[model samples]
Target: MPTLIRPFGALLLLLLLCPLAFAQPLPGVIASLAERAPWSDPLEALGTLSADESVTLSATVTKTVAEINFADGEQVERGRLLIRLEDGEEQALLRAAEALSAERANVLGRVSQLQDRNLAARADVEDRQAQLDQARAQAQAQQARLANYRIRAPFSGRVGFREVSVGTLVTPGTALVTLDKLDVMKLDFSVPEVFLGRLSPGLALSATSVAFPDEVFSGEIATLGTRIDPVTRNIEVRALIDNPGLRLRPGLLMEVIVQQRLRDTVVVPEAALEPSGDRHYVMVVHEEGDDHRLEQRSVMIGERRHGEVEVLEGLDEGELVVVHGLQLARDGLAVRLLGVMDDHTGVREILEAHR
Candidate 1:
């Protein structure tokens, strides 16, 4: 029993003498410090691209379409005839009315001359003038009726695909076509009220369409809605883009990039951010006497650019941040600095790999 106790005591003494290593302080890569420098202005929400103007063409009266002057999907100019109905009777009436108007004018002129010669009542000249005016108004009405038989373009734009054809009956309420003016385009998007202060009119913006993945359309903030939507707690924003070639169409799905929102921020690689629960963090490296060490710090992040994040707070300029192996890190742990993560070898490199 004494011999057994001696061996057990000896083993316990050896264990007590051993100076255990505390898990090598969790390995991580050090990211070299970037002086708190001015970063690009950040953007928060997206926008869409729409037509600058969408005009709905409508008829003024009920009539059977005699001829569709413009073909489907036609580009029309202002005042150009787009459709025509049977107008023989209306045209004839207009001509007769014009003749009557000319006769009334002649009578008025004769009455005026007689008044000058003291051969006519002042009332008679006035009556003749009124008759002439009525005749002219009748002629104008007939002219408008004739014009109604033809549908004319109100503005220069591209006509949407038509659902009507020759001989099809239509009315004043029927939608003929949609004429969209896309020389300059518009974008309508929404943002939370929290970003209300960040949004400013005339800020530069860019958008990309899924249909054309390779293209990016640039634009500017045109206007903002006066009220917020109660259901979404969001406010609507409008952006105007120049579609010089008329390539973009209405109802296009897009991804928008609004610029120049944030004044100054520090941009860092996304890998350096360590998120836990509701907060985010980044490990900072420091020296202790003769040993290198790590310290965990909370960070306030702002906008994200590609694979980098904007550090809003909890970090100073010219501080080393940990970018890799943060899952095994702790506060004030002794660390060995092999090398530092850099623009070429750190988060920037990770983002390029994904891209």
Candidate 2:
């Protein structure tokens, strides 16, 4: 009986050691080093473009159009004569006023000479002076009235299509053309009230238009609405963009992206994140001699942009995180370092290159 018991004890010891001898080898995984990078979560909204200055030109008096100096859609300077009405009558009246003014000056000069020589009464000299002043005032009035017959540009801008042709009789307030200063464009958009705290004048923004698909227009916040819209819970924002090329026009729809504040933070590939319920975790790989050991760490994450996740806590720059073969990773699990991933390379590329 003693010999049988010894043999059974030896067999039990062999069974216990067999499991350890046949254990599976550690798994292999791809990892990436966490690094610091500038990051910002941009805010997006739709906006409309408008000229820096805009106006509609119209006739201020009833007159027949004698000459239209500007062509349709012409660029004009300030005070440039744009149209001339039938001014023959005004010209004749101005000539007559000038002649009368000349005659009054000549009579006043003779009367002043006579008064100095005591050949004329002092009252006569004073009366002649008053008549000369009145004649000059009348001439000045006629000159002003003559100016009303010509239409001139109010400011430097691009003019729209002409609404009336020469010989067309225009009444007061008759529409003539539209003018806009297009050197700078004003972009207006709305943002939710929740983002109001983040917005301020001079904040940079970029805009894109379907009309110019390949071009990106840049600008900054110029002003903010004084009051928020209670019904929509939004606030209006205006940005000024330099439109040197005059490509942007009024009433153009564009997509706007407001550049938020940038921050430097540790980031890792999104593939390395292990989400469970509302919590997130990453398997951090620690180098142990020639082998690597993974420690499942809970990390506080902030923003996720592109394929990278911003690690707010529990991660540091220069640390390695498992990105591929995460399904085989766990706390305290041993892993083989297959390869490293980088910002410019994908996981599949790294894995295939290692193979």
lDDT winner: 2
What lDDT tens digits, residue by residue, belong to model 1 across residues 1-355? 8989999999888778874732334354556663454555545566666677788877788888887777677778999988887787888899899999999999999999999999999999999999999999999998877888888888889998887888888888788878888898888998888878878898888888887899888888889899999999999999988786788888887787778654666767788888889899888889778777888899898766777888888988778877765766678877665556665565556545535
TM-score of 1: 0.66
Worst 10 residues of 2 by lDDT: 346-355
In order of appearance, the predictions have TM-scores of 0.66, 0.75
In model 1, the worst 10-residue window by lDDT is 21-30
Measured over all alpha carbons after superposition, the RMSD of each candidate to the real structure, in angstroms, is 9.0, 6.2
What residue pairs are clashing in model 2? none
- Model 2 TM-score (2 dp): 0.75
Whole-model lDDT values for every prediction: 0.80, 0.91
